[model samples]
Target: MSEQKFTVGSSITESYRFLADHMPHFFRLIYGPLILWVMVMVGEQILLIEHDIHINSVYFLNVITAAFAIVWYRQFLLGSDYASYRLLIKKGFSNSPLSFKRVSRALLRILVVSLVLLVPTLLLSFSMMVYFHGQGVPLSEAFIQELAFKSTLIIMLVFSPILIRLSLYAAGFALGRTSLRMQDIWKRTRGYTVTLWWVTLRAFLPLSIYSYILTLFLDVMSEKLSINYIVSTIIIETLAGFLTFMILAIVVAANAEAFRILIGVRDGDVPHRDGLKKNTAMPPQTNRRQTSKDIPQKTR
Candidate 1:
């Protein structure tokens, strides 16, 4: 078994190089669907502004992100050799290689992992929201809601590293590399929890710093220019959208890279030699501790 240590710096660097090498095609792959998604987002923002509410509605945007992420993950894992419009998400939904069932299964697994970690925080946040809204102060309603939303985001950011431990399932499901069961994920990723956390921190640290600085700069610009408040705010809200998309794309690739490395080891409770297949028979088992057959063997 290749019990090699996870290299955080190398993972980030390799993912960056990979994206740099393939960015044009990558953008084409995501452009159409992403544009429509942005349109809807802008429409929602306009509606919110009309209602005198300032907070951005992000739940739908998150779903759109996840949809594109599946495409990116599968592309990286399956390689471009597979002849499918897997890149064209709009076409891919029905006409591409991924079956409706396969996508649904992946979505279900993602939801399960997300809800497990999110439920407790959500419950507490919900209680706080209910308590505040019941106070019935009209002006305070939007303020309280936005406060709760930001608080939830902060809590999520704090727990982000912990979320990375279960990332194998995220990248894995995109290619059906592992079973959907949480126990399977836990056993598959055991002993490497701390390593995954480090990867998350390194991957996101730059984005966090960049975000803070960009907000400061933009706020200064908004004040100095004396632009329309809604326009400036919308521009600010979506200013880092592309950078964020790129960073998250790199993170998804990094997760896939980590999965390819760690999934090979014949670790605790990972009974099979090759990875778990989506609908086919399991690969023949092995007792040699490790064999390089499931994923494309790479030269290090």
Candidate 2:
């Protein structure tokens, strides 16, 4: 079967369709990790409530959960149907989907890119600070702050394409590609950066709006209700966590879809009509008797 060529929009739509078709299975696959993550988060919240610690501690926990969630999502994308909690925990620490070597290389690449993009901005900011200080202008002035913010935004816009191009590394790592070098990913993603950007925006923009609305609603409820602030905090955190997971799932699915399409093109794999084969191997046979029972016997 010739591989069906898909445009960026079609590829994204197909990815959503694939997720919808396999929603139940995906939920089942992710439930274990999700539950564990929720538990950890709730526990952390409870501890925070008791100790009255700064919210920074919760941020740390969120980082941990996000890493684990990424690993689990990657495993699912790679067709792992069953992942034990122990394995998930271990993989989270080990960054299983991305090997240590690949991660190290990626980090190095990121650092180089960051320095290249950011060093000039940093230098400019430093020079501005020194000049202002010498001029008896405080660095805390609003003008200085706005300038810093604008500079950062400009840098981000400039580097956005490079970042998006490298974004597929997670999917590549998950798929266990032997050659996921930065240059290789860049070459493969050539001409598709804008498409990938569009797909990502389509996936996340609505979710962001939805989350903002939900947050406002939660805030209003907390204000109107007689419930304890802790209870409100927990509720807000739970909902936020759920939304975060949903976003992560969508991102993983979309990126996986893009990766599949790119790899298919690269390898000249015919896109079969079967719609991105989830299972490369043949399915198990059904019982002959059950199959026969479904067919009406002809009476002479």
**Candidate of highest TM-score:** 2
For each candidate in the order shown, give its overall lDDT on alpha carbons.
0.62, 0.61
> TM-score per candidate, in order?
0.65, 0.68
The worst-scoring run of ten residues by lDDT in candidate 1 lies at 270-279
Off by over 4 Å in 2: 1-6, 28-52, 55-69, 72-77, 82-121, 124-138, 141-149, 265-300
What is the clash count for each candidate, in the order shown? 0, 3
- lDDT, candidate 1, residue 228? 78
Tens-place lDDT digits, model 1, residues 25-107: 46765675466555655677677767756655577677667766777776666554321344444444323475777668657
lDDT of 1 at 157: 67
Question: What lDDT tens digits, residue by residue, belong to model 2 across residues 41-72?
Answer: 56666777777664544665556555644554
Q: What stretches of model 1 exceed 4 Å from their correct place?
A: 1-4, 51-56, 81-111, 122-162, 178-181, 228-238, 265-300
